[model samples]
Target chain A: MSVLLSPERVEIQLGERSYPILIGNGLLGEPRHFDAAPAAASALIVSNTTVAPLYARALRDTLAGRFQAVHMLELPDGEAHKDWQTLNLIFDALLRHGCDRKTVLFALGGGVVGDMVGFAAASYMRGVPFVQVPTTLLAQVDSSVGGKTAINHPLGKNMIGAFYQPRLVMCDLATLSTLPARELSAGLAEIIKYGPIYDMAFFDWIEANIDALMARDPAALAHAVRRSCEIKAAVVGQDERETGLRAILNFGHTFGHAIESGLGYGEWLHGEAVGCGMVLAARLSQRLGGVDEAFVQRLSALVERAGLPVVAPALGLERYLELMRIDKKSEAGEIRFVVIDQPGSAAMRSAPDTMVREVLAQGCAS
Target chain B: MSVLLSPERVEIQLGERSYPILIGNGLLGEPRHFDAAPAAASALIVSNTTVAPLYARALRDTLAGRFQAVHMLELPDGEAHKDWQTLNLIFDALLRHGCDRKTVLFALGGGVVGDMVGFAAASYMRGVPFVQVPTTLLAQVDSSVGGKTAINHPLGKNMIGAFYQPRLVMCDLATLSTLPARELSAGLAEIIKYGPIYDMAFFDWIEANIDALMARDPAALAHAVRRSCEIKAAVVGQDERETGLRAILNFGHTFGHAIESGLGYGEWLHGEAVGCGMVLAARLSQRLGGVDEAFVQRLSALVERAGLPVVAPALGLERYLELMRIDKKSEAGEIRFVVIDQPGSAAMRSAPDTMVREVLAQGCAS
Candidate 1:
């Protein structure tokens, strides 16, 4: 039987714009994989320098039959390059090649490429259709599923962006095989988050399969990605703009963003910052009596075991506070963090500055 | 009687995000006029240097009752300043002030200020509430009513933007009294467009009262703005993202955008370029047998009477063709023009290259 016959599909129902997330081994070679996207006269595949050599040619070849012309743009790699200057490169390519509003953009790399391409599609001629073919584990389980597209600002992370959905999100399990060990651990940080914040049972599953995930087991990775997507889809569907419950999905993002912005973008892998941030947020939860101290300890151990940072960098407590104050969740300069109420529940609330400072002072390197 | 008590209100319905446009002689000074905006602790008034000195103080004082703090960001004036670098200035003020997601942005200038501020609000912290306090006739009638917000790219006009709606649109007619003669005439160009594309009766009304509008008669300006808004509201309500009916709204914009892009943005006031483009389009419409040549001459005469351009710029035909091809309406390298079917209806179509060249050669002033 052909690999196309039975690939697992995850449906993200967003009214008329609903699309599917196709997951399976060797799915990139299957033409049927792009079924959700409408056929356009031209297709532009945006990838990074690192990932282009690995997968862009095969993806382009697969798209050749459907599109009259296929174009490829290889941007410099890393989160540091995710800004307006780099975003302009995609627009320059699209316009130079005479691509029109109906053109479809295929993002063929990690979160940075997916995000910038999605934003380019969203703003190009007001809006256009784009497909997310995320290759990183963090993206497959997290960023690629939701319609949140953005680029970082000098002062903040994902500061400039739009809530633009993708035509489809294609996650090929085979691509993760080529990911670096450090990058793989970063993806695990996000995978580990869904359990404590949305589903405790999934959290337990992650704890049990952490070894297999690290070892790159196909079955284990598939289960983690699908479960994470389901939780994200349900959250995003209810609150597409993060006006309410959707903010819960940024479980460790408040602290993680501070670390990322403080250290400068790309210094710590996004997942690494988030991993350490989750620990800080859990401690804040314990301090607020929302979760037990033991809950914080258990979560930190998992992050460490996954080879991610359990402790944040030694940015002073005042620096951390300054960075966190400007977060989107902050209201009138008051920071609101997503804290765990229990093993599987999360909500946003402001903590005392003293308590937060204590968490920062004591939360490092543990 | 207070001007706010008898202000004409037009509701732009877009489901839950609908907002009202208030048109009156001096609505800015009335505290009760901003009742529609959600109460926020902080408000930022984004105005240009030209407009800020004139009205920022009054708007700030009006907002002071509802908001705890009101800040002003005075951007440099002109379409030349509408780029990413200038847009960054708004971001700098927002971040420096530690403004939160709930902080409202009040766009208090013409099309340039309003468009940039709306986009800044849309992208800042994913999205934020904004109010369009358009002070120019051009912005009051066209740019502010619809949720189309963007900044120009070196390669195109309004290329980078989003369809983000505002909380309220306040068009204080008294402010237009300060507009330059050339600027007032530019505004008339857009006001003239509403008639040919959507309402022939309004077209006749404009023809009859062209002198009254030019004289800045409050009654005449009020009727023209109100009717133009009603038609724009209807079009935008039916199609917010320009997927279909909304393209009709860009009646002369395809060619107008070409001139704006080809001349380098800000060289011609947007409405000036559009006035000339309307004549070219009307001529093209007659050439294609969509309308009669007499209709073209009559429209051209009215444009001239409004102190606007009737003949196209002497940009080479090839240059015009090259510029028009990248417009938002173009598809698969085909340039789509919004041609008149009669005096009051418009649709998009591509004309033969030779006929377009002929129109250009005979249509330009030189």
Candidate 2:
């Protein structure tokens, strides 16, 4: 199944900060995949307890030929550990090892690992080169491609971070073979996200290949990852800083963030909350007359089919509003949401409380 | 003294990230000084316990006319407090007050406050617009002008940070009147730094007016800050990230950082350490034949007259080497020093341990 698809590359054109996203099977073990990494005396692979045991060794071995020394540091798994303490662990390891400005960092695993490592690289000695070796479908499709790196603060998600770009992003599809079933579905949430916000053709393809993707068919997953990266690369290339068009990428993130913060980080996988949040955002789009009932229902059905929750937790309307107000996107206490102006189109807008309440009342469980 | 000098502006050109350094007497109370700050609903003035009582209110009052709401958060004073624990306070205040990405931050103190606030603004929601309101002489001439912002780690000084720029830098000369005599001397260390590294004319000016600068003469202080900023701005504009040419600005910082880290931070103010470090670097420069012994002695005498210690701390040879290997300027365990090529020029070079040892032996108190 792996031999059925060839490797693909997506370029994120950020001028001097530009790099490529390499996607294929078994790319993690191929030293040639990392040929573009900056020449340095040392390389450090930063992963988590779970993924390190699975893929860190392969990455270190591949990098050994290029660097004089290759080291590995595993952080505790999950979003709960994505704080200053865990981030400092990476710094401590680098300083302890006497890593210098030229040292390259490789982020292995899911979104949590990618974000933290990208941030650690961004911050360690001001800035250092880093490569992303994303193992999960969610990261391979979304987080790994973009250079947005951050750690979660107790008050808000990704409250502290930098717009630091990575030297390379390696999405080895083979690693997805070890991903948990629940996690695969969470990744699908982000893949499904691209369809509603930008491309209906991609959405149609996902709806048709949902079963093949669920079964972990290599060709179907390859196309999914490739298309997702292409779309993301295009959006990010245009609005790398999220000053305007980039906010559309957060289509479901306002509601998604509230749920994650309300339930506490790590309670629900980020993709899972985003999946449900997309449904709520689609519903709000209908209330704003940007989309029809059919489109909202269609997105909800797809979200549910992806094995994500369509119904949000009953955190109460006031609590939800409070959480969203503090989201990084909000300004002057107004919660800015990414609403679908139409299928395959999105815009950042603020909905009135009465209308938002109606969407919440209908989306949340009683 | 206050009316002797008119407001002056030095432009730091870095393309879109370029901003001005405003220098004058009583600039903090003038609302017109901050006209260039981004329009936002709210602003946060991050200061220290010592500086807040003195000028936070005046700055806040000036900002009130622009921003709908203005708030203040004061952290403990000194270099000892420049850590993650202190950095998080700014984040906590921003999130707790529901400050968004558009919210402006004004750093209202010396190097410690400016570095922390700039870092908080850089990391808060990826990045935010911030203004530097440097109060101390050192900050006004150095830290505030450059976009280098970070907190000290247990392992190293500024080992974690970002090259995030500010929208404006305000240097109110009036604030220096209240500065302690020792701190004022520390600021002179940085003002003196510009002479050997970039401009010998500036160095000559400092040598001649050292007494007037100590007396808090507004005209003398204003000229010192304006020239120092102009030199820094020109250097920073050419190499904002310290990739090559920018590193020359750390003419004495390599030795200064080791001294600070060896004795523990806050034991010696950054400028004071640099004052002494410059003497040691000058001696090393003489050994390397970059400068002559007569030049080194002349610089050392000026440092002493400015009330800064010309002799280095007795941290021993090995301790200094170990501390210096971890300095940010060092690459791959090899210590890089910014040696004076001549009286008016500097270069980043690596000297032998034997040479460094001899210089340390002569410079440090036995």
Candidate 3:
């Protein structure tokens, strides 16, 4: 059966300027996928040491046929290396291989690779064209869709970056077959985010089919990836730079980033951090009169079902408080959280330390 | 005579997405001036050790009254120091002072400080609201307005950064009063860039008043800053990410960056390197049929008039070609130059090394 997907392309209308994010299957090998990118120049593929082994050859094999040349720059995997020292690999490869402003950089890995490649494209001789070909479910569903490109610093995660949207985001569901089960679970936390922040019904659907998703069912995964991209594209299209509506998309990120920063990088996957963070935010929401006990329980059950860490790791209350205050969402050192009154509805709000501490203590109870 | 000569504020209209460029006198002390920046929950001011002592106090004193509270982070001075290690200083300062996403950052210094501070602000917790309080001429007129914030790398210049915009760009012409004459001349290189790429009228104005500008005449300086900012704002507003029209803004940058990269940072001022680069670009432009001997003579005359180097530094022609190819702008190691077809019109083009060598050789003749 030769099925046709609408490509469900969303244009991030920046007026006389805009870009598309394409979501579907078997996209990597398709020539039509990159027609929007600059055709007169070379294309650079920046993938991780891991992802390159699986998909780089096919991507290069595809682009090399049409473009003047195709080259690959393999970066070491993990969040620890997503800093200046490691990002230079792309530059070193670009220089060694000879890529220019017209050179289109394809980020063919997960969040680490996509963010690094995106930022590299953003600052490479001021900026260059980049396309997102996210392999991991987490990146396909979130990081690759938005224009937010950045690198992690020692003091914080994603501490250096820019709001540079890709020329196109090609999300091929077929790639997820190779993702680790733990990573697949981690990606769900963000997918679950869309349903709660904007579509309560979508959350309920995931609630019912959590088992099928855990098995990496293609139909289920495609639906989740396509819908998540739809929601993200819609939010980002309207508020591309998170000045307003897009902030809601960070439903659990304010809390999630705190946990990630508090524990240090690599100890927990980004999704794992958000999974635990959502629990605390749910509790805080209940106290603030934004969300009730039933809502908290509903979300927690989903977190647990997704095979994510539902309970916060035991870092002392002071450290938790200190870390949360250092969050990008904090103002004047005041801790902020993107809280939900109910599924599909969210708000960015500030909370006092006393309430946050109580939620932290409750989060550790499990 | 209480003559209030506003530095002709230019409105860079991107609709509801538009921002103002404040080009005038003693704006730091004016209470309303700080209001140009939206009231954020928190704010951080990123300045250099040198600029901080001179102006950070006034900035903090002003922003403290507006933002939730002001946090100050001081970094070292000079291009050599504007790297990840220096950027870590801002991140460390933010974490130590407990800044969050709601915090707005104010970049209070020249290009080195502005680029690093803007980069720190962009990467701090993914992204944050930043204001550009540019002190030097190069920054006040060019880097400060374009949202092209970055730092030089061990391998290349601006290899790490983002196309992150500032909420407001406050160019206090008074700050230039303290800029050393050599530094002032360095900035004039960028001032000369506008005349050739997009504004011949401004170029002629610079040619006419070279002496007053060299003397750091406030009126002449303010005029240059305002006109340059307007040209930059128009270009950036049309092409915020250097996709097309914005590339023209890099007229002298390709050659300038190679010199900076070859000699290593801080050996010569960025404007000085650019001053030299513009001369080489002019010669290259003449070779490629984009410019005439008359245009080259005008550029050389201006560089000489500004008391800046009008020839490529003796870093070896082979080294120059190799370094230029590794720049963020180079693709597949093929160097691209933003050459003028005529004064006020520029384009990114490729040329032969044989021709470039002739230009390199011309530098030796001098």
Candidate 4:
């Protein structure tokens, strides 16, 4: 069965590893999501408890029609469960079920589920084919699109991971209907990010259409996802390994990740942390003369209006610094921040401890 | 200081991931071995307890001259310890040392150390540069050059892994002098493999120089390693991902992995298992009419002469079948064996269960 909405497709070109991102409503029912996926003898659907009951059966049925055997592995939901122990569950299930390298894995959940499954597939049999059926807004626009598969370490976010590309990314917007309002707001943080980092026009659109998106208007959600993925696809196509250009896509992530790790992962939703992170990043950018105070305020106002935190969490200046220094972007002991040069532009740069502290103090309630 | 024999370099070209394999004695002390390595702030020499006391100090001294921080993570030696827990030690040390992505890891042991360190580099910060200073004949000739890094699972050997290539592979013949005779014999199992699978001439050379290799002649070891790496480099360059041509390189691995898993990892050194596995594969080839029994007997004689197990352990047919089916090469429960079409040639094809059973019955002592 095909979805009603004409699926907007964005191709992430990395030569032989290039894959298509299919964004559409009611895509769970669409058989075409499995079209580009390699015809495997068996398919394993990896979803969390929160997502399995809603979409696992339909996904299994769709996959079953194509594969000889379809197995569903339900993981405990939440970012805290995204570790090696939980990843082992997928490996255990795959091995028990006699799944081979040809066995395809379908990641059918939010960012946490997608990231864990992608990593599981990446390591299983030294790498296997996986299809990302992203159910949450955070996954569709960011994590699932970029091929950055990882499991978080206690010391850092996405510490143990791989640059494994997926065979196909199916973003079924219909699944977002079951999403909590908090999660929807969290996803908007990433959505709001593309505007300041790559395209100011898209930022303008997100500002104008925030309400419509919060309302879960299918058209608005589809357009936002499509545009965000397009920008991500373009950036990822240029730098799949995050050597240079890809760091810009992490516009607010350096600070965002610090906030996430400092407060403990899943304490704040990844997007929520990133949303707050964008505010701090904007302030830091302004302090560095990349942008003005007015621009920072404008972005902060939008983040707040999106129902995300405009103010940073009091993770403490030193603790945040400690966490940020360990971030993948940090070279030597110097912490690199992906600061916005201006609207529609961002680059990774290091700032002095005093200036970073000044922004943290100004942005946090403490 | 440079050694007596000039080091020969073999380049395994995989476009951007292409790296050098330096084969010579006393090369580890020479700084030229690391000339191509990315100049990093720190270097973590990931060796083991056995290798550490013997060579870590010298390697550390050599690396310390170049890198500001030269840290060593000494793990428990042996294949039994090559699991996620031991790998975590490397991760923990890197994090504790404030090692960043620029931190180059040196796998300074045999196959186990090289595989673990390479996998660590592959996962750490998504990807980092690693140098393989393989100290065993098996590793120097095969595992070190190909970039097939992995840790074993309870169900299979090398089950959990990644195809992460190293920046450089340094084979110091001096280290092999300390290798136990049994360990040396195990390495010869892999060295003898090159002839039957890829080069008949190399096979003839191995038959001719078996005594020279076993006697620990430096020139003999260097020549064997250089030729083995050349065959491996040619194979790996043609098929980096092991989709087609690379599978042939695992001429005996399908059966060999089963033997290792059945006997339990470390019970039989990897090369010993492969030596017996090559005999089984040869017998299977004869059964499939791919080769004559003479080829099987000839290979088995050489394996026995080299002090490797020519007869397989009685793992029982059912258990062997169970283990072999889960191998990465097996497709859809059809156990694909890399059979010798003739000496110096191999092809992956599935044999019938009955034929496989017969081969097992003939090969196993039971």
Candidate 5:
């Protein structure tokens, strides 16, 4: 249990609101994430179907010992429920439990649960504090780190979210044990993004350790999770709102979100969509002369070795263009992809159709 | 024409990223708000049905003339429409317009429009720059001043939103001419809030000039707008998120939001609800020993003079308690109100039902 918790404090530097993200295991049962939260008039833990069976009791056990009062609100699982209705469940729970201003929401799930919970926290009382117990590889490595909490809009995935930094992000790496392999690989999509967009050296490391990383080897996984959070924490610190520099972190998200939205929620795993999206983004970058073909090959090789989707579906080039247009990355009609100008540097660029069609073709190729 | 078209600059002192709020006569016809905007490749204006008919064309003409290209998306109006559907209208406009990362949005209307448009801009393309052109007095003074933008959720008012600061806010006071009396009165509720929460002198000024403000006296209106923006700027500058000192600004908002939710949206104008809400909050403050009964009488006079509803309806104490419990401000069953300790000073206090019921009776009394 001691070894499960990290001594290193993961800092989310959002001015006065900045707080330490404790990345570890058994910490859910520890006093930090739940019990140690400032004693409020009341507290409520918001979780989802999937993660509750695994960690809710442990959270309650830890928190129950500390406070005279506590309540839990369990929500239905998956991206489909990440809407206003799902968010209302938290309100229903709070009202039922009689929780008030000092209520602390404990998000006990992957990205979807974390997002809805965090969003409920943000809007619950204009705002309230929430602890992120990211129970997925993607959330641990990415979503739970940056404090970008949101629920999906019908027209778009994650279209209605906020740039709310979290009071705490607890990445219990051990939770990945319950995650499906596809999800594990999807999380790697973001892990891969970290390399091409910010750190070429990290990309090389990920490439070298692809097998171990994919196998969820504890050492490789920890190294990846810790480094990913550090990179995200650093980027978020520099630009908390994804204005300019932080947009680069969405290297493949522009194309990825489109795929998620186009295919419909839960149709494609977010990381899977991102994985295919990175390939398209890399090809488009090469087409734009921002990134050379070799870098594209190197990135593609890592994605393939990690058992992630390297090829997008054969949704016609026109359809791909249409889908990408609806993406969050697009402003008006231009499709902007976070493309690598070079290894360790990324830029947001609008890829016009012919070249985009070519990239889409390449991405769809087996 | 150049000088007449120019927007008056109100500098909100934040940092390098902070931009000026433009106040003038016909800025919609000129490129003033966009001229100083960070040079983007394109511009997108998020306007609602009512606003688009009157101002969107002028805004588009200016932006289209200034930027390489510009686009306008007209969303439906009213607080009820401020949801995922309305937000997507912005997404549709952005995508259909081919806007890219460099796109900036101009929000044109009152709080509903500003909030929805701002939230749309905040999430679109991960994040984007937006300028506020708040037409109503409430928006000019309150919503348009601090960049607290959000969209409302059906379960709760403003349950989905972010604390996304705007690049600039343009308040064309002339737009208030078209504002309905109810809308104007709603906006006035926010204007009056500034006096009790942070500016006593302003409170005295408001009390003295309530008639002028109701009559839409230009000088009085402008003075109220500028002062509220200043007070808001100072508070938001210190605490952008309502974590500590900022929560004081919620003086009547907690009670008001509950009323908005409990009564069902569209049933009550936000300002009218808040106007009555502040009376209850003041009474609660009196009960809590934070302020004297004199504070209650003095504030009630201004509220009544503004032609706003000074008495809350008989929601039934149980129903009132239930409604307040679902408020974004409530957590464990305790309903907290931002009560005045004295003029220009406010603090949050959670009261028991006996006191809240007593206040409810007084609040609902005809």
Candidate 6:
């Protein structure tokens, strides 16, 4: 049984670049949802091969009424394909079709599609307008909402990108029904992230409604997506370029990125690594006198309950340290991490290698 | 004889992102020129093979006092190498050296190196502080002053890039002494541009000093670089994103891009194509009754005197139209040319195919 409700909107206040994140059921295939898009003669919907087979026609048909010409391009699926080569596919298609600066691009599918398309729009002809139509839970609540668009380098995740915001983000709740269970858990990791860094109450709510969220309950999912976007939007609005406050959003990313990089990206989903990374970062936070052991255990239990991996892969401590030293947040080869300074607060700080090694020894599988 | 004088500064008044363009003799090897650069533990000087042998060491040595560690990377020379692969080399070096987000990047070459490095700094870890040390006259006068950085795609020149500004632009007039005569003329092509689009007095001054400029007279060169930067700074300060007025700076670029793209990039220098493109664009302006025949002839004579090709490559009418249609300014497959509306004014507008074809027929080589 579907719980019918009006679409919820979260405004990301980025001055001239501000846009809205719309969350609702059956929003796709609805022409009204895309009315905020800039007037253009052409609209290109860039989706992944996996997502295109499911929802491309609905989107193209919906945009047809507004744009004189609507086109679709499908890139190969997954994080493995999120590189310059895959990004070039979008540019290649745009050039082939003679898409101009006014031509808007719609990013369909998950984080990979959203990121690559967002970057394509950012770099194509200096910059062009693009909209995010997030089809996965990870994208809807996290990647799609932020203007942080990038592609992975062999050396680092999001090593190449731009701080370019999308004109609008459409989160169709209906798309979640098709997401794999593993991906749903991964999305929960990012949802769980906002709580420890910015809002303990939201964290408490996530703990309480964890089961309902897993069941794809529309009301529960809607609440989770809206709250996550609200907190993220508030943070991003204040510091769009991650000068200071924005780094807090990357809470589990330092360790998560290491795990992803150590094992090679795509070995574990970004959210899965973040889920486990949050647990390790929490333990590190406790050791650094920011939190208590009780808080760390409580967070770990929630990450496991959400079905994300609690144990990081057994990459050597040296490799973990090496990978993290190259993190975007690192300075002068020193790894700076977003650690829980308090129950509802986070800050970027550096810990000694001894403490980091101890956490890795305890957190990684032998 | 050397014209020793105080460094002339042209402040590009872009709020917050604003920076100064410093012009004078021997500014490159002086540490004082880089004082405005952000304090960082490391600095990477990215140049081309052709330029690194001449100036990389002096730049690195000067930066050594400011940054704890100074690095150098020399890319392959020429416009042919301005692609994603070359851009990635900068990323690879940064990551390899464990350079942090705070690491400063110095773009220490002509437009190709500057464009690639600027784009690299703009994208690396989202963004990093970079300074433009333009060695070529073209770069000093045009490319380096504006934050228009990009790498050429197979389909178009600068199809992928960002409007990221540099912290400082250092135009060492002394470096122009080593510039090849052909490249020197290419630089004059840009200097000639500002006069026709925004300032007729500057055009008049240029006509009076074209011989001195080609001869590399220190006083004439300094005035040319400074005045060109002033006109550019005024234009860019008002329209940073090329939304309206900034497009005027590209008066010769639409036809220039087609010429470059038609013959393939690197076949002729960018300024050479632009030089000829201005001649064609001026003739088009005459056809549209925006300017008289005398004005076109004046511009054409000036271009020829500058040692740039006045005759366009005979790429054929259909190919020219096809190439122009894919230009970034084109909308809905219609080409928009930045034509001279009056003697010292320009506007972007589309012309009849017959008219464009007629100009192409006469302008191109037999």
Best candidate (score: DockQ): 6
Pairs of residues at least 3 apart in sequence or in different chains that clash in candidate 2: none
Ranking by DockQ: 6, 2, 4, 1, 3, 5
For model 2 the local lDDT of residue B193 reads 89
Instruction: Score each candidate by Cα lDDT.
Output: 0.90, 0.92, 0.81, 0.90, 0.77, 0.92
Candidate 1: the clashing residue pairs are none
For model 1, state the Cα shift of residue A62 in Å: 0.6
lDDT of 1 by residue, A19-99 (tens): 888887888988888888878999999999999999999999999999999999999999999999999999889888888
Docking class of 5: acceptable
What is the per-residue lDDT of model 5 for residues B128-170, given as tens digits with 9 covering 90 to 100?
Answer: 7788878788788778766677776555666656677788787
Kindly list the per-residue Cα lDDT of model 6 for residues A13-81, writing each as its tens digit. Answer: 988999989999999978998888999999899998889999999999898899999988999999999
Deviation in Å, model 2, residue A272 alpha carbon = 0.7
Q: Model 2, residue A46: displacement in angstroms? A: 0.6
Give the TM-score of each candidate. Answer: 0.98, 0.99, 0.87, 0.98, 0.84, 0.99
C-alpha positional error of residue B204 in candidate 1 after TM-score superposition, expressed in Å: 1.3
What is the C-alpha lDDT profile of model 1 across B171-275, one tens digit per residue?
Answer: 999999899999999999999999889999999999999999999999899989999899999999998878888888888887898888888888888999999
**Candidate 3, residue A65: lDDT:** 62
lDDT of 3 at A322: 73
Better of 1 and 6 by lDDT: 6
Question: What does the lDDT read for residue B204 in candidate 2?
Answer: 88
Standalone chain B TM-score for every prediction: 0.98, 0.99, 0.96, 0.98, 0.94, 0.99
Better candidate by DockQ, 4 or 5? 4
Model 6 CAPRI quality: high
Q: Is the docking of candidate 1 incorrect, acceptable, medium or high quality?
A: high
